[model samples]
Target: MRTAATLGPRRRPVALMSFVAAATAMVFGVAGCGSSDPAPGADLSPAATTAAEVVTVRDPWVKAADKGMTAAFGTLVNSSRADVTVVSASTSVSPMELHEMTMKDGKMVMQPKAGGIVIKANSEHVLQPGGDHLMLMNVASPVKAGDELTFTLTFADGKSVQFSAIAKPFTGAGESYDPGHPSMSPGMSMSPST
Candidate 1:
């Protein structure tokens, strides 16, 4: 029965203050419910969702070279629930391509990988000498030993991941131009000597 309108003059301020406080508490409580905190079972870790977050390069290293062409090796690890395909690669040092070694005419030849390299979910794709690797063509500067080169790998989904790899002296896998594949320019190396 003690309505605000019927409150005494001395008690009217107290009643108004209580009403204002309750309104403020309700407003803040509603806002708190809609905060940015993730819901239960939601993944918020660094390894959670997104191609850039779930994909990582392990033990990345590039072949040291004074100029021309070289290759980079690493283990592409995918931690997501879906597969990620690397369509292309690039760096300030040179233009890069995803390459793979295959047996051609009884020779192990390296060529531009068709459809790119796919890193399966919860698995790893190794890029090693005489195997799948990232070829850096027409390097402008020398990639000296202990030099760190940054690279960007663009995925099929338009998502990209950036990583850095150290350069190391590697004389193995002497690659030569494939004469059978005349389409490849003379400047390109297409065959890996087995």
Candidate 2:
């Protein structure tokens, strides 16, 4: 009588067939599990959605001034799918207003931004010096370098984002304020942050 080891050549084929059979079974078993219909009374409702902040303030900083007026500059990015307008700004130091610069006749005129600053979906609204900026008027005290100020930005959707801006002495000759700007005066000094 031949033992299984003695019939090695013939037994090899049988072993391979058994392995193939086992592998096929395992593959079908796992696939069948995912294809099965849901059990009775199973909850099929979609997942609940949560409100997320879509507005982001980047590199916010306040320009230090000797007088009672200064400005804040930063980039406002809107990540939401809908359009958003920044309606107003508030701070403890003074009343804040969104300002925009435009050429009136031959000179630049800086005034309150009309209809606020509109930040479109997935776009950025840059608030920089001598262009679009946050004007802090009637400040209670002069802002010094290294001072921190808290500001709240309100949007059209009743959503508000609070951020802190550090006061810095920014001195660059590339941009200049309009002559009619509230901060421009004979004794007033505009020093850029170092």
Candidate 3:
């Protein structure tokens, strides 16, 4: 797994003054992102206060080996002084859910847990095939290996995190990241381009 951070241009630096002032008091501060409707710099509900726990989540990637079913995996990080719970997720897909890929009845299955996965304060979780992941059902288009997907995460406190993914299949894909997703894989992985 590799990690990198790239900050984008601030869309609203002025409107955020008040929010920033409040967040600064709590010791958490983040340049607001998401939503074209937010005032100059209006933040996504949970302002960054030191006690506010800031988080950065990467959208899940559907392994190239995906067939009728597959999973998109990524990471979530709480970069704040406090802790938080990721309440929900909002994406282009409907009934957007947080699902887990684990061994059930001794067979690898991607099932939805009771509540959304918890992203601990200052902690991280990896949503990968054969593990915790976001299940994309009936993918509208075929995403070949090397394609990308964009998604957003809605936190319990109402904060939003956005990220994208580059598609890749599991090792030998037929089994490693298989989620039996129904719309993801067909027991095939792309051939290597030599």
Candidate 4:
């Protein structure tokens, strides 16, 4: 059989390009098959903190909504010697509050996290949909797909970090809202925060 070694160097570039194209197409095709939600900003690059090296935020993004409530999702990693608590957050679109969703009596309920979010030292905290996330209540302007929102997180130690999140349209109704538990079935209902 004529192997790649025997095919000579001229045909190598063509074979490589074809292989790359096929791989890229396969990746996109598989990603599209997972959920009906648009994956436009799913591949956003994680951003780092410029103010402090001990804390780093990654994969920050916001859900697209017209004028109501929405949330910011991301991962917060703490590499410091002491624990850090995110006391509050502020955004130009609306007022921000730390909220969490959970399964209560076979229903998903959203509530305000009174003490805010805590990221322990040498550990990571994930702020995502159906879990502990930053809430944007009563948004003034419309947040459409491909839009960016800037927000700043203030810690208890008076240190703050600023980041931007890309807004993408999403349907969070189907999420189970169970933090760290995936065995539960999809579909979560949220009640007004108390």
Candidate 5:
């Protein structure tokens, strides 16, 4: 993926992970609408398997961009199966691609990933900004607080899981490890982990 040199004047991407390569992966995206209602046919049943595990994406959120661009972050995990390929993703925007941001040749570039990301059945992948972030090109509208969006993950094995994530104001922070974000610094205090 190709990423912009600076997500903003204050936030610098620090997360390290690839959006492509087809071997263990992650993806993040913006909220199409605000989060409040429930998804149709929401299923929390355990997937029958030889091993005890839950397949899901963890902590997904979108970071606001000043220039009508927004980035997504989250974690992908497969605790039961070792062969899972993310076929595709659907969002409010008709066009969405798995992207990664990094300092390449002294510039930030964001680009679409080749093929798709493959996750080993029992491992996890991180989708962090400045690295493997989901970019919503030509944002439909100005997403703000109280807005929720829907994202569906399609697996290679014909399984589609729909999850809803809300858009949080981007104060320079990008998910869990955006140290260069405007909200953090060496002199700043770190909140205790719950």
Candidate 6:
């Protein structure tokens, strides 16, 4: 047998080059088998992959107010496989707070939500007049009917979603904001008017 050591220097180089080319071709052929397409049962939906994209607000509306404080109501829908929490909200119109209504001293009272508003996976959280809502405090300008306000809701994962809500006149909730009252405990009161 003619070994590489006995072969001419030029033939030795050509044989080495052929071996290298064959190895490269084999490696690339194996690598090309991995298709760019997602595997079967893989989730390709935007909501399933993103945090803020998974949550959406439906029928969003703000309670019209001349000044002071007001609230926004809507249905928060989460379409992801995991739950999402609305940790905070922001807008140029006013400072926003996540609030909830609860019974205190035999009366319904509105208070700042301690943790946040949690929207369960594939479910909805209703922000109604007498339920969990977004409170706009010390509005810089009057919110009139038909006026649209943009708000950014920050999630627990530091992701945020921007949404627009139309202001609508509503006066039947019996909700009142008193920043000075000690009984309110850092929020407004939602006691029904007697």
Per-residue lDDT tens digits of candidate 3, residues 35-140?
5446876555443453223667655565553333345677877766455665556545333557765676676545565567776656787776455667554445
Give per-model CA RMSD.
9.1, 9.7, 19.4, 18.7, 29.6, 9.9
lDDT of 6 by residue, 67-161 (tens): 76788889999988788889999889988888887777666667788899999888999999878999886689999999999999999888999
Off by over 4 Å in 2: 1-52, 172-194
List clash counts for every candidate, in order: 0, 5, 27, 0, 18, 0
Candidate 3 weakest ten by summed lDDT: 185-194
Q: Give each model a TM-score.
A: 0.71, 0.64, 0.55, 0.62, 0.55, 0.71
Which number leads on TM-score?
1
User: How high is the lDDT of residue 67 in model 3?
Assistant: 34
**lDDT: which candidate is best?**
1
Model 2 agreement with the true structure over 145-167: per-residue lDDT tens digits: 99999999987767788999999
RMSD of 1: 9.1
User: Ten-residue segment with the worst summed lDDT in candidate 2?
Assistant: 43-52
Query: What is the lDDT for 52 in model 3?
Result: 24
Backbone clash total, candidate 5: 18
The worst-scoring run of ten residues by lDDT in candidate 4 lies at 185-194
Tens digits of per-residue lDDT, candidate 1, 80-189, equal: 87888899999999887888888887877777888999999899999998889998877899999999999999988788999999999887676554555544666555
Better of 1 and 3 by lDDT: 1
TM-score for model 6? Answer: 0.71
Worst 10 contiguous positions by lDDT, candidate 6: 185-194
lDDT of 4 by residue, 43-143 (tens): 33222232255777889999888776778999998876567788889999888788777667788766667687888767889998778889886679988
Candidate 5 per-residue lDDT, tens place, 1-38, comes to 53676454654344423334223322222233437544
- Our tally of clashes for model 1 stands at 0
